[model samples]
Target: MKIIQNFTDYHEKTPLALSIGMFDGVHLGHQSIIRKLNAISEKKNLESAVLTFWPHPRTIFNPNDDLKLLNTLDEKTYLLQKNGIRHLFLKEFDEAFRNLNGEEFVRQILVKKLNVKHLIVGYDHTFGKNKSGDFSLLRKMSDECGFKVEQVEAVDFHEKHISSTQIRNALAVGNVKEANEMLGYIYSVSGKVIDGKKIGRTIGYPTANISSDPLKLLPKKGAYIVEVFVKNRKYKGMLSIGTNPTVNGNSLSTEVYILDFNEDIYGEEISVNFRDFLHEEIKFENIEKLIERLDEDKKLTDNFIF
Candidate 1:
């Protein structure tokens, strides 16, 4: 997909059938909207596009809160492209953008600038200054501007609405199995592998330490059975997320130990997909005790693997 960083960068000759939102997780609900967008684009022979904000509007408005992102920009782009979106406009949500009023945004940006042929939005989507724009306002603007507006209802699973917030909550509680069920895929963390104190190596379980995106939402601190992807190969692994209490507990880290594997992965980019939470991280009495528990973790992980 062609990724346009700003609305001004949109120079496509074809008018766009667009979906607008901060499609954080690209969860089932978001996918439903995107599917509708694709159908509209196909029917109209227009480009399928998405408009999303960077740094998330929430991160800007609430800077002090721990802003955890479900997907990084790269990850979001990949998911959108996989779902048939041909263009993406990733706008930087800054002070100037915060000032655009609802009508001004619709008239100047969506209509005059993007030449949006049709718009697909989530049922509860709101936009413009102070989030004053809603489906009603969008419909009004679309009617005046000669464009169509489509609102997709929230997707539900067993009476629960599927949302990024819900997915994050599940992961925060170490419910990877349930989180994956909602996400329609395994919950993954992608990052570059970095150097770490060779403590795991000393204990015969050499690990590849990964540096997570600062803005990415992390699952709860615990050990988990996971699949590690490096060099396009997926390997069974045990991942740990915690501040090692047994060893001072000064710094928190996410480290993966590939089962029966030994290879230098420093500087390599990898993604780890959490399959299930193994156990809570705890302080062991000694190295021997830690090794014993790790051994048990390995056996437990093996049983859970497909």
Candidate 2:
């Protein structure tokens, strides 16, 4: 996909079938809109484009709130490109950009800048300052602007709409199975392997310490069944997320012990996909007790089907 960073000097001669949103997790609901865009673009022979904002609007509006995101910028970009997006337009949501009203945004950015022939938006999508723009406003202006507006109805899972916020809520409490069902893909975290206390090795279960992006939202502190991707190979593993209380550790950490695998993978980048929540972090009475729990975790992981 051709990524247009901001509406700086780029211009598309061909009319675009466009959709605009932050598309945070690019969850099922977001995908439905994109799929509609793809269908419309193919039918009308228009260029398919997704106009998204960077630095998340929440970050700019609510600076004090430490908001954790489901997917990083790179992850969102990859998902958009992989799922048949032809153009990805990124608008930096700074103070100056935030001041644009509904009419101004449509005229300056969509109609004039992108030459959007048709706009595909979600049912509850709103834009402009204070989110004053809505389907009614867009429909009213579509005639003069020489464009059409189509709204995708809410995509629901088990009666509730599948949303980024819902997915985040699921992850916050370590409900990865529910989150993945809503996401249409496994929830994963990617990072570089870092050195640790090597405590697992002492107990016959060596682990890879993953140091992920601080902005990445990690599942709740606990043990989980995971699929670890290392050097393009997949392995079943049990991941522990917590401070090692039995060892008097203070800082929280993520460590994954790959079953039946032994290798020095320090410094390599790896991705871990959470499958199921095993148990909450426990304060074992001693190292022997901790080892016993580790054995149970491994047994459960072995039986965990992908």
Among these predicted structures, which one has the highest lDDT? 2
For model 2, the stretches where C-alpha displacement exceeds 4 angstroms are none
Q: Rate the local accuracy (lDDT) of all candidates.
A: 0.88, 0.92
Model 2 is weakest, by summed lDDT over 10 consecutive residues, at 5-14
Tens digits of per-residue lDDT for model 1, 200-285: 99898898989989889889999999998989988899999998888776798999999877787799999999899988988999
**Residue 107 of model 2, lDDT score:** 88
Count of backbone clashes, every candidate in sequence: 0, 0
Model 2 scores a TM of: 0.98
